[model samples]
Target: MPNPPDYSWSVQAQQPVDYQVSMVQGLLDPSNSSLARACGADGVRKVRCLVVVDDVVDELYGDRFRDYFGAWNIEAAWQPAPGDETAKTLEQAVAITEAMSAMGILRRTEKVIAIGGGVVMDVVGLAASLYRRGIPYVRIPTTLIGQVDAGVGVKTGVNHGHHKNRLGSYCAPTTTLIDTEFLRTVEPRHINNGMAEIIKMALVKDADLFELLEIAMPVVDAGMMADRNPLSIEIIARAIAGMLSELEPNLWESVLERSVDYGHTFSPSLELRADPPLLHGEAVGVDMAICVALAHNRGMLSKEDTDRALRLMCAAGLPVTDAVFTAELVSEALRDAVKHRDGMQRIPLTTGIGSVRFVNDLTDDEIERGLDFVSQWAAEHREETA
Candidate 1:
């Protein structure tokens, strides 16, 4: 029994990972060379791409996509999966991975291209990460929400059981190519859905962006494209820049003091539990409203500021109140968030329009009071608007 012969060993290493998030106008257009270059299809003899697109996106631009890829000398395996939140599951990821494998996708050279909204990106990106342990992928976020928030981040996840984003990974895409042209086809409510993340950025880190949202809400509500409304473009640009600035340094979230979590802390449960199934941004809007009330209760934000924030959300057509957001639900969401944040609720709250503070000592009493305050405020605001 020679003391096990000392067989254990250790190795230490450091690896740097960097990826680009480019904003191009017409990424899928046959004439546009940006996507081709981003995927390294320009100089390559034959580039193989396994595209996991949202079913809706495929319906809208399938022929054009095929034409563009063919013109670029790339062999593409196009697979469309439902992009709804209900479809963001492990099963979908497995299907995409299996499809890619059948298409002869090379682990190192061939790329998995996720082309659609946030759900498509999450499922496909997760599949890409799981296959062969890791593989390259590109994100083409079609929805405004995907472009400004989900698409730029280095996170891939799917829902499990009753939890939102319970199954996931920290897999970064090779590149995130955002094209505003895709926003043109998004429905009005979906456009407003994307505004929630922009509003979150404004609430947590950019007062200037908040003011711009105030100005751009009317244009956005009118469903004007960025070309027609310059302010709209400016708003999108500022939101993307703010998100990237916050995420670039904390990609792995090694430091948990994340301002981007302002509206996200308690929204996951709310999003998953709603009867009508609130959109991701809609749930976030409700969560932000609650945090605004909590900040006001703590005297960190003025009543005027709180009302203004809520009003901006209203102008953007986002919901500030939902029947499903009861005190019990709030408590449950907080519990889930606390567990996710390693037992210390790293809840992000806005001290002002553009500043944030994370607190770990939130009491149940405070949550109840905040819920009451928001419910009252929402009632009064709704009457006024009516």
Candidate 2:
């Protein structure tokens, strides 16, 4: 048949992704000029930029950013977005693009600046990815979760149809400017929320980072950002590095059997289903707790390590269990995860602190027994945590 007349042609290539995850303090300080340089603001030229700020972040330190642009002779158009879980929606992303259109945003020469928490970062990055078929954006993650976890990675997303992060893209930013100083004013509970990610990294990789977190817990009572001490800074840097190391090799998430998926296997459903909507990190903590119990039950993780992990989570101010984390919910979440993980559970279970082993044969009976163990342990030790 002469190869069916050979009508098909194929093009295979790799899209190179390069983005800097820089740790710099005083990002908004006019004297710093780091952010100005990232936005391509030359000293003599008049540059235009679109700055999207979370409403709460705007109220907290918006004026400083305003002055920063003024000092650098850059024209900034400010767009305020709601700073809540619900803000991660398609509508919000489109609204930011609308603002970009209103400002006549320059495609290649200019960049969009997302200066807020994770939701604002995700929504704005999604807008940038869609606008003009992809534009450069800079992230200045104010919250701890943003700096250590969300800001360091190259993914943009928004929620649809009650699914957490159901719509998203692997759109890397131009650069992510992380300044721990912004976390100084973050709420206590939010600080704990960020700690959950750090703990996840500790559980999955880098035992040294885990010990440092344990040590720093006492001094930095308001979470890692309360005190800019050496211990706190070291812990933050280690956590960021650890997450990036895992992400760099798998930026597109081409590999589903990822250790970084330790707490995330069932977190999407838990995050979306919890009444009042648990924070991303909170949901992850609950899932990690469940997985820890499962690992212990399988003899993959020691009871001592399981107790220590749960205790540390409690000490770090993360919720280890919740009403919505029922066995039925766990079953549903695991089913979804199997589909998400490309037909295998590939669930990451911590065999010991800072190590992980994936298992595909986890059954419903096993999960139920694990949950019962976790419930009993949680009940017995809730009073003794920390």
Cα RMSD, each candidate? 1.8, 1.7
- What are the lDDT figures for the candidates, one per model? 0.87, 0.88
Q: TM-score of each candidate?
A: 0.96, 0.97
At residue 265, what lDDT does model 1 achieve? 80
| Each model's total of backbone clashes | 0, 0
Whose lDDT is greatest here? Answer: 2
lDDT of 2 by residue, 1-386 (tens): 36665488899999999889888977877889899999898667989999999999999999998988988989999998997998899999999999999999988898899999989888988999999999999999999999888888888899888678889988899999988888888988788888999999999998898888877776665544745678888888999999999999999999888898889988899899898678999999888888999999989888888888888888888887888888898899889889888999999999899999999999989888888887888889877443
Lowest summed lDDT over 10 consecutive residues: which window, candidate 1?
221-230
RMSD in angstroms between candidate 2 and the native structure over all alpha carbons: 1.7
